[model samples]
Target: MKPKDIVLDFYKSDVLLDKKTVSELLHPEVTIDWNSSEGFIQMDYEDMMSLTDQMARAYIRSKIRISHILQEDNLVSLRFSHFVKTIENPREDMLLGNFFVIWEIKDEKLFKGFQMSHFS
Candidate 1:
């Protein structure tokens, strides 16, 4: 699948609350640098799964709207806004963030991914 397609699928799965599909789109060795209200958090695949589970427990109603996608070879830069409502709070609290993801694809499967996100 195209890199953009993979990303769109990731967001679609996330919106559907399908963890399996989200996980399938991720590379096993993925590295994520996520900047949030708390701080800059660095994570790998295992950590990503843990975070996803936590979000699920929080039962967030989320939507990701992609503004732009730029791809060259194996690198992808995505600009998106993630809107979410925390189940516990039930308030419309949105996270506006931009992501830059670099992928290493081999044999049509993602071997590795490095991502950085900034939120405001």
Candidate 2:
């Protein structure tokens, strides 16, 4: 699959919460810059793995709804909404909010990412 397709699939995998699928799509030295209410942050592959596990444990059910996707060469940009249900109560629909992300693919794997988001 194309790198962009892999990323889209990765977002869809939020519903499944499959670590294997998530891991397989990432580059070993993946880097990420994330910005949200907490402010700007950065991460490496290990950090990404840790967050993946935490997210799986924190959200009972979740889905990423993509609004748009654009790709050029190995770079991709996407706009999406992240929706989830907490582990405490799986009924309440918590919209962690919408986001825009730019991803860089290296050797057909997701090697870098930058995200800006708003949380509710």
lDDT of each: 0.65, 0.85
Model 2 C-alpha RMSD vs. true structure (Å) is: 1.5
Question: Compared with the true structure, what per-residue lDDT tens digits does model 2 show for residues 47-99?
Answer: 88888888888887878888899999889999998889898888787888889
Please, what is the TM-score per model? 0.73, 0.91
Error of 2 at 51 (Å): 0.5
For candidate 1, lDDT tens digit of each residue in 1-120?
777566566666254355676577668777766555567777887777777777777756767777777777766667767766677676766664555566555444444666666665
Model 2 local distance difference test score: 0.85
Q: Which candidate ranks first by TM-score, i.e. highest?
A: 2
Candidate 2 off by > 4 Å: none
Steric clash count of candidate 1: 0
Q: Local error of candidate 1 at 59, Å?
A: 3.1
Off by over 4 Å in 1: 13-17, 35-39, 89-93, 96-100, 104-111
